[model samples]
Target: MAFPPQVRGNKVDPDLLAQLVPGTSSRADVIALIGSPTAKATFDDNTWLYIGEVTRPVIAATNTVLDQQVVVLTFDGSGVLRTVERKNQDDSVPVAVVSRATPAPGNDASFLQQLIGNVGKFSPTQTDTSRSRQGGATNPGNF
Candidate 1:
């Protein structure tokens, strides 16, 4: 069976984008035309970003990116649009992920140890006394 690609983030329309004029459009005008941005610049408040992507499900529930669009808008000190930049999938840079796992402080058990670890930990005859003290019925028939 085929599944539709998942669309994420806001994709700007070219017609509406054309209406945004540098030095003329304010932050409010941009918001009215294309809605709010997906995110603002981490360090600079004047820069806003509208990012979008389409991903398809691949093997083992992993997703592969099919398309990506990023629109970067910069505003001047007066809040007037200074520049508008658009980027596509081709402009993206591939990032390599590290496969090394971080070592956690714990005992690493084997497959057999993990499978039978709790074998004798629970006793079938053991009943929680706390439940009986709290006006709750203890099911002696249940193990």
Candidate 2:
């Protein structure tokens, strides 16, 4: 069975993007032209990003990226568009993942130890009959 390519993120239209003039377009004009951006820069609010990707399912819970697009827009402090940048899959860099696991503060116990760990820790609950209201009557309904 073949799976279709899944489209994700904000896909910007080329014709609409062309309508945006860096020095002339305002923040509201960009939003009106291409909707809102998918994300904004973490440290800079003036920078906005529109990201899109097409991916196909390869294995269980894994996807193979077929195409990617990113449009970066920057606005001046006065809210006028200052610069527009476009990037594709070729511009992306692969990041390496660390496999080292952090050790916890507790000691690791064996399966047998876990099963028998609480064997004798609990005791049967005892009741005090001397404080009973009806002189240690076994059943309150009997009276």
Positional deviation of residue 113's Cα in model 1 after best superposition, in angstroms: 11
TM-score, cand. 2? 0.80
Q: What would the TM-score be for candidate 1 when compared with the true structure?
A: 0.71
| Candidate 1 clashes between residue pairs 3 or more apart in a chain or in different chains | none
The CA-based lDDT of model 2 is what?
0.90
Best by TM-score: 2
| Candidates' RMSD to native | 6.0, 4.5
Best by lDDT: 1
In angstroms, how far off is 46's CA in candidate 1? 0.7
Look at candidate 2 and tell me the lDDT of residue 44. 95
Please list the C-alpha lDDT of all candidates, in the order they appear: 0.92, 0.90
